[model samples]
Target chain A: MDSRVLRTRRDVLTAAMDELVEGGWDAVTHARVAGRAGYAKATLYAHWPDRLALVRDAFDQVGRMPHHEPTGDLRADLVGELVSFRTAMTEHRLDRALAVLAERAGPVPELVEVRRRFVEDGERPMRLLLAPVLSGARLEAATAMLCGAVVHATLLHGAPPTDEEVEAAVDLVLVGVTGA
Target chain B: MDSRVLRTRRDVLTAAMDELVEGGWDAVTHARVAGRAGYAKATLYAHWPDRLALVRDAFDQVGRMPHHEPTGDLRADLVGELVSFRTAMTEHRLDRALAVLAERAGPVPELVEVRRRFVEDGERPMRLLLAPVLSGARLEAATAMLCGAVVHATLLHGAPPTDEEVEAAVDLVLVGVTGA
Candidate 1:
């Protein structure tokens, strides 16, 4: 609440991000974070109760990345959604967060819920945009193909698609899904 | 090694998987795994000196999931590859392992190398199949979309696509990519 308190929280989260980027999510622990931030465990605990809480707080720093508003032009909208997805991944560090969430190999119910929330939230617009145009398995397949391609192009290639590249990808997905 | 040594290794690996699935990759530490498997830290350490080593040893239990051998029939091979990928995701627990690897959220160099190796290995067949059929940027987009779609349909849909579904998806992707 106060300036010093806010500053400490900022420092803690910056360390959390540092840990997250440098070592991955598993590396973010209270003791490790306190050490990184030069704070006492008690002080860190005073603000956040546990590792998940701390992780959530650190990620929540970004809150929700922006989603695109559909312009009622199907092709335009598709390209827009893909561009937005790429932007969130590149600029907002969504890909890194996703990588961290994804590596939970086992069936932790709460973590599953969290992962679902993040993924569904990220692709919500894609679903909504495609809803009116397609349905059932076709829509599901289309959503997956488009979003998946974006992921591949972005994370694997490690670059956001240019507008022309995005348009080209959209055309490929569109023709494939629409089949016309 | 002796039978007793082999059994100890098996038990440690099993506990690592349990921790991986239940608590994620980070949860697989020597002390926790030793406790879980009812062994001493020294025993676990003797087998695996660190967490990554332990994680690698556990995952290597399912190393190099069977990739599809490319059939000459492009359509048949595409379907086969997609089906094989779906099988790997479901039967081999590759999805769980991938999730754990994905959530690291940091830029740990070795881990990045490991992740790249896993992703590339899994999709190697797809790339090889597409190389002659497509080239340059088209080839890249095609690979991403095809593999990306398989990931979505497999992981997000949480079911292996039926032959019909896989065919439909392959057809959609094929048309989009080949444009014929």
Candidate 2:
């Protein structure tokens, strides 16, 4: 794909997300998104072809944002992950858009696949960081708990966490895993 | 209230919740809820003058379900709370309905009061159980983390936890707090 085309697709996706947050998922029609992006409807169609595809691509972009690198220290890694999760929840519209999409997706297979991809991708780094600290079932359980907590704090509370809060939560989870 | 009237009101709320889960918050209009309950719109109105009041009452009823008693075992109590939270998320429509209502209420004093009451009621048992295990800001932080994790698991994953999952998560938090 041409760089310009990629850039335009990003623009349209970003614009669509803005509309989604501003007016809920119902407002994210192709025409509205195109209008918001200052692009013609034909241009959006040429790039995405379907609204779900557009949404999927946008969420994919969100899932790929740079995350904190694990430092081989479990507590530090967890704190870093919590901080990143908090920042994404607070500063990014993608989390809100994802919540709206998840509610509306229902049993739509394509949307379900997109959601799975989004969640797996988002969880990948955290899982890696936590792997060394936990074994077998404990690792899996801890990962779920961490991801679940961060997402809940952000989406439901509408507030990103402070460093102190993140640090405290990390400590709690770490003690569970290490029995420190 | 007459026992029969109370039963009928409960039926109405249950129907409204079913509609909410089946078709999101918008599907729970007074007429549809009344229809689902086999009651006339006027009957619903007699019970609740407005949809907000009805939703508020329904949520309050749902929220007031008995919490797990603190077993003097911190891990056990926390696990019970997590399980109950998961059950509420999966079995009741109140969470989604509250999300919709929150948007509508948006900083309104009545809504704020309702929210305060909800949080206080939910947090009371948690505070009591966790107090023996944690103190100061750590107690509050652990409670928030546990609440956030359970809610996220329910709302985002659509999975109410099994006892095993609840025990695992609670173990993680409690171990973390106690060990730290």
| Model 2 lDDT, full chain set | 0.69
Each candidate's clash count: 15, 1
* lDDT tens readout by residue for model 2, A25-111: 567789999998999999988878887777777777666856888777777878887777767766765456556755665534466
Q: Give the TM-score of candidate 2.
A: 0.84
- Worst ten-residue run, lDDT, model 1 chain B? B102-111
RMSD (Cα, Å) for all candidates, in order, is: 5.1, 3.3
**Over 4 Å off, model 2:** A46-50, A105-110, B1-8, B42-50, B93-116, B158-163
Docking class of 2: acceptable
TM-score of each: 0.73, 0.84
**Colliding residue pairs in candidate 2:** A176-B176
DockQ of each: 0.37, 0.44
Candidate 1 global TM-score: 0.73
Q: After superposition, how far is residue B33 of candidate 1 from its true place, in Å?
A: 5.9
**Quick one: best DockQ, which candidate?**
2
Q: For model 1, state the Cα shift of residue A147 in Å.
A: 1.2
